[model samples]
Target chain A: GESVGLHLPTLSVQEGDNSIINCAYSNSASDYFIWYKQESGKGPQFIIDIRSNMDKRQGQRVTVLLNKTVKHLSLQIAATQPGDSAVYFCAENRNFNKFYFGSGTKLNVKP
Target chain B: GAGVSQTPSNKVTEKGKYVELRCDPISGHTALYWYRQSLGQGPEFLIYFQGTGAADDSGLPNDRFFAVRPEGSVSTLKIQRTERGDSAVYLCASSPLAGTDTQYFGPGTRLTVL
Candidate 1:
């Protein structure tokens, strides 16, 4: 079945450094993508989103890049902080209603 | 001004038992969704309710899984003949009417089948 997946299971970065998480999706029909952050004992929280029509979208210290040709998406976070340590996942909207999520990448920000 | 909320933060059941999970979506949100998350993995879509009706139920694993939203506010997910494989965190989310809107997720109900 068509699904989304992350390139790495874990990533470690310094507090002041920038972090980049990668995701690859197999569904070409997907038109929307989103990044979510899940902390310990909490549900997934919305981070940022991008549509197929656009290549990149930016939010507060976060950026989502979409590459439809390669079926890849990435989330970039600048100036990583302790509070940013969590599991990050990429989700794609293929059927226009339901979202399929990736396994997830654990982001660990070192002090 | 509250976010999505789910009842019985944690549930423990034995095989062959039945269980019901509840979800309360954000106020005024017209779209509700249910998902299942296993250990070390992301959420998998199960069903979606647009208002009081189910718009999509393609993600439901089998007939043992069922859900309903009568008043378009509180939704319940019922599981029958539970198996050990059913142990997972069931998540609920809500969004605006638009399909592409950002979804706000609840804390989730952790179900453990013993």
Candidate 2:
């Protein structure tokens, strides 16, 4: 089975506001989770990541949360800007050897 | 180079034709992976090579798809008798080692099977 998926296909946020994108994973054994941002016609760019041992991790203006019990993950962006508009993807990493990427959510920042 | 690279950015071929996608990983990276992504979908795993041997080929969809990383630096994904359903963006990634989850990805090769 595929490991990760998103509940929302598209999200819009007012510029300067905060944005949150949610993801659900099927694999209970996945220990590491990562969030990526991909612009049009470009590959995914790493945003932030969190391990199973930590519930949350922060990087720049992005934050990642991991819930082991629910197998859920989320990426939060503070002070969202117009430049933040892109497709957001969440990936699951298990066994530290394999990764499964989730269907991305397109986030639009309204100016 | 410091980043992964893929060649033949776009390819158009008829059904039953053969195709090969190439990838060059970052210098000294030992783990290379292949993935396929269709329109409006996430990338799907295909195969992985650690050093000269494939460590995981379980994700390969069928026997028609084959990949090789002979020297552990440059890798190739080969498809035979390509079908329309085989059209996708072939992506390649490389990590320092298989044990590290952080992988750097290339721009990918867009394959169109008609």
Candidate 3:
């Protein structure tokens, strides 16, 4: 069964600290991955994305790292803030058509 | 500059009833998608549409689920004989193109099957 899963279901981080969320995907054919943040009552917002050709991609205060060898992916948020407290998800895109999402990791930021 | 929008933010219906969920994509977006999210779980892909035609519907769970994207801008997800398990948030997303693009999502429609 092809699936994407997270290593941790919940992560609690103090405000101003860095936070890392991990995910493992089973499909080798997946070439693209994205991280999304969802707040209560709102839709999932795109944080960042990385292609298979790149090992690391960085954005403002955020970074996505892909490890094709181990079939793993990670999203790192620098200087986590209270507003960053939300459920984080990692999605894998296959054949450039469909995306498979993992059960999210709830990030609780303590102010 | 409006993002994707879904109508009837919430719906409560009895089992075996039919329901329709609507989605309005961002202007100029050609790709549309439907997803279902269970409590504490991530969104599950249901279908994808390119322009006015369905490009891929293999993710749909069963014959009870169907979707249409007419005129290439709006889409409706239809569910027939809904079951209790159908209770979930229905999410709609659209991208400028079919693949490798950022998908803008709408505040999902929450369906409760009683």
Give per-residue CA lDDT, model 3, range A26-46, as digits (tens).
999899999999999999999
Q: Mind giving the per-residue lDDT tens digits that candidate 2 earns over B61-111?
A: 999999999988999999999999999899999988886568888889999
Model 1 misplaced regions, further than 4 Å: none
Per-residue CA lDDT of model 2 for A1-111, tens digit only, reads 645899999999999999999999988878888788888777777788888899999989988988888889999999999999999999888766778888899999999
lDDT of 1 at A82: 96
lDDT tens digits, residue span B11-111, model 1: 99999999999999999999999999999999999999999999999989999999999999899999999999999999999997749889999999999
**What ranking of all candidate models by DockQ puts the best one first?**
3, 1, 2
* RMSD versus native structure for model 3: 0.8
Q: List the residue pairs that clash in candidate 2.
A: none
Q: Residue A60's C-alpha lDDT in candidate 1?
A: 99
Off by over 4 Å in 2: none
Two-chain complex of model 2, DockQ on C-alpha atoms against the true structure: 0.68
lDDT of 2: 0.90
Residue-pair clashes per candidate, as listed?
0, 0, 0
